[model samples]
Target: MTKRRIFMAGAMSGLLLPSIHAQTGTNTRIRNLRVLCGFPPGGATDAVSRRVSDKLQGSYADVSLVDNRPGAAGRIAIDELKRSKPDGSTMLLTPAAVITLFPHIYEGINYKTDDFTPTSTACQVQFGFGVGPGVPSSVTDINSYLRWAKANSGAASYGSPATGSLPHILGVLLANQSRVALNHIPYKGSAPGMSDLLGGQVPAFSGLLGDWLPHIKTGKARLLATSGKERSALTPNVPTFAELGFKDLVMSEWYGFFLPKGATKETANAAADAIAKAVRQKDVIDAFAQLGLEASASTPTELGIRMKEEFRLWETTVQKLGIKIEI
Candidate 1:
């Protein structure tokens, strides 16, 4: 049979026949495909995981599932992934920080960057600093808040998702650039930290732009500044740290897909192709936008390059900041 006939047969049956071994023509049927997520069911990570799983299920002929294994800020789920066989049956959909930053911060983590293969980035979201009533009504933007922090005791305090997380790093950078003494309060996650920020328990909150955008719209919180090269599309009125002169402060969090390190080239390529196709769909893009996420995709090789670059960048940043976590 011609190769075209084989390809057509595989497509019709929802199977990838001999994708990695065209010469041998060993047909591989993908089954019980699991997309593992490290966070709880309702949070951002789980949400993104389920979305991708839904899209892939529609595209693939096999059953796809999103399995949440929440514990230790994704370490448990990652450990589960590390133990799984690298046969393209299991994949992880998680935040880039989990792969890029966690190793440097946690002293006793179970996984390393070498344990997985990069597929594609699913979406990107910006970071921001939010303010609540503890900050005086006169304070509007980052510069004014900096000035106010210098005089007020609790005004300069800020909360982040966790120690050594990107938001924590942002606060550290802000202190260094503005030469202000800002207290860094680390929370288990952004939800509770944002809660304090909105309840006046904390004056400032540092986390994703999505976490605070809703409250900002309702007049319940103030987005002092965003952490991106440019203002977020959803909050154009707010200035970015870079535009305000701290160009180094620009950053974004990403959700990305990864397979086990030993997965075959054909497996990785097919996975990347599926995700690239899914994210480009108008409905998927619009859904991501509504969540304040920017939909994006990259080839497996491009994702690998990004992973290596980000691993280097974050490694240096963590070292320079002397950031570490007890657990």
Candidate 2:
């Protein structure tokens, strides 16, 4: 064959090889999606991840599994995701605390918000402050609670899920704003923290609404105020911090999905579309509602923007509070 013909044939072969291989099923089917959650099973993060995964499974027949890699305040799973292939098959489902707050609070975190491609924000969950029944204050709102707490002269202590978790930060912020001196206590997990609160071991605890809802209903603990901009639908009578004149006290934990960094924009968009479809399902919404979590999804761009805003807010708060740790 002529030299030009030989070169042209080789170029055509190069183009057709991949197509032939793909058609032969040598390419992995875009099924068997794996989702990573950085919390143990039965935790709020785990519950939300599973709910989203089930919805995704229903919408996309390919999704087959959801994996939990809970450790180091989500850093372990996040690091694993960073080292994963930049393919669409592996997804990380986690709360905003890991991405936006961990890097600022912990000294040795290896993954940052930029390390992953955001797919979609699945939901925003509100937090509530619950005081053990032992506290003398029968206050129902933040203002009254703060006033009573101040009168107690730092005797009131609050428990948080972990040392540098979102609830810890919220407790610190609440003390700073309300001029209430509170001794901060940290627990290994929300379950333990809620246990102490229910048993009247701690005067108060601040964490996810889901963790505190049962205790609230059982009259073991009283809901002081929600940390969101508005009252939660599950607890409409509970006033928000903003309504009580603490506008800056807003805090809501949120979860989002991410693919490894450098994934193609097409792949990211496809994942986001899939999650959005999943979020719209009635069963998914109802399931999350049962956990006191609002079911919603945002575009990848919106997730990015929200992450940036949250990072800035947490950075400032951490610096202001002088919270430094080596987790």
Candidate 3:
């Protein structure tokens, strides 16, 4: 009848269960967790979501799923996340731009930065400016490329994942700063833009580095520069925009996790712990590297700070660029 004996009896039976999830320090169990993704399957965003979902399967929920609702340039998934409950059962994994940059560019987005709770970031990827056979082989670096673009104004164009994406913004910055007349060709996704780049339909492409890796290895594409403070590890041979005297163009996109706005701090911390653990694993890091992404984690507070900082930065940049989406 002693307390220790009674506790031992409960532990021997199933009465003292659910404490097993205490390894994450939170006792909440999400029976059917759905990680909403705005991109389709087989894309970078979906891959990140699935990788984190794998690690969260047993620890955070009995089953973890990635719900792909790709449409309206990743707005569909965000809409779904807005409608989801705050019980920690629904989570969203998306690029930081969708939350930070979209609001400034899109005319009628229903969600705002405050609509979701920042949980943690899964990975970050740098954008690359590359050219395929469309450009003259002599155009090797950014300076030469600018010269060529300036001379061949008719053929001077760059394709990005979308009109309002970070890559698009970077392209616009490059064109304006360099005083060139480069046109923007926005594709629905990186794949199609990459396809056009490889086909010589587009002389230049600005997108995630992963989209250019395959062609780069095959000698079909050449990376002129990347959008990062330092050179990207994947393409160290290529200089960064900052190195090329584009100090204002240093940027990278991070994919972050989120919950409904009303989720409590406990739930947010639990999800962040699981995501941080998931992204730090050796396999996850290697996988992200193959995808041209750097696997890293951040606290809820850190993620929130990053979101606010990037949101304000984008607001100013977008307004300055005067770029807006019709739909």
Candidate 4:
């Protein structure tokens, strides 16, 4: 039941930006760059931004900083981003859900889909529903969790990063599809949510796989299901929602970089190339792979097309899922 959409154009359109550097063949236009992150320092999105910033030092002489501006489920940072100068010095690197899902759910957002230029998609992350000591050990996977929810009235509640977030919406979809009621507990961010899970304050928690994978590996929390179509390479034994016959529950999470509106094509291309080169490095890929995030970089055009497609896809999916917030 996964919603399928086809992207017609090829992803790679070789741009001359890589070679169009100074005749000296040095990338010397070193301006201090700021990579804006909407989430706090501990989440997957922030982690990816820091990694990219670290690796980018090799591509340019600029001093890069990963700035976290967390609030309103990432609206604050994005609003700031939309208002910044159109120069390529400042960019937003955060989860695509903030771009694709927020406009539909949150009212009075200052930015629109066209407000920022999609630069590159850094990588993909999937969600996980992790259970802690508050839950009975008999409920192993999402299927059994649903069955248990039928028997246990209010005990079927789950915690997510925040309200109206992908995890929150996915929790609602799970309740609807499974024909059971699942309450939601929204935290300020994933770190707090995971902390509550580890402390057994919530019966279950939904967060990116990276947020819960280490706990799952250390036998502290049980990852009942992932939101990917296929099993994660880091935890192949764990079943995905699609693997459990809930195909419509699948939605891929991507961390994307976007420049301020009106950034020149040359600037955009330079930024994209630097990021793509940084992510493709062996150490970065290996580190990301441990968290089940593959190092996937896309051209600016490809990211733009993807943003449009995702915006459209989410419009349909949110309506179908009947997810609307009064904000």
lDDT of 2 at 2: 13
lDDT of 1 at 67: 76
Instruction: Give per-residue CA lDDT, model 2, range 98-180, as digits (tens).
Output: 89998888877766678989989888899888688657656766777777778886567899988888888888998898878
- State which candidate has the highest TM-score: 3
Q: What is the TM-score of each candidate against the true structure?
A: 0.89, 0.88, 0.91, 0.86
Which pairs of residues have clashing backbones in candidate 3?
A: none
Stretches of candidate 3 exceeding 4 Å from the true structure:
1-25
Query: What shift in Å separates residue 102 of candidate 2 from its native position after superposition?
Result: 0.8
User: How many clashes (backbone N, Cα, C below 3 Å) per candidate?
Assistant: 0, 0, 0, 0
Question: Which has the better lDDT: candidate 2, or candidate 3?
Answer: 3
lDDT of 4 by residue, 1-327 (tens): 222121222111121122222314423354566677877676677789889998876465356677777666677677767876666667899888889888877666556779888889899988888698888888888888888878887778899987788888889888888888999998877888888888888889988787877798788899999888888887788898988988788977888999889977777877888889989989999889877687899999999999989989888888887766644
Model 4 clashing residue pairs (backbone): none
Sum up the clashes in candidate 1: 0
Give candidate 4 misplaced runs (Cα > 4 Å): 1-28, 290-292
Backbone clash pairs in model 2 (N, Cα, C under 3 Å; residues 3+ apart or in different chains), count: 0
Per-residue accuracy of model 3 over 1-327 as CA lDDT, tens digit each: 111111111111122122222233557877778888877788899999999999999878887777777766667777777877787888899999999998888777777789989999999999999889999999999999999999999999999987788889888999889999889998878989999898999999999988878888899999999998888888889899989888888889999999988989998998899889999999999999999999989999999999999989989988888887755
TM-score of 3: 0.91
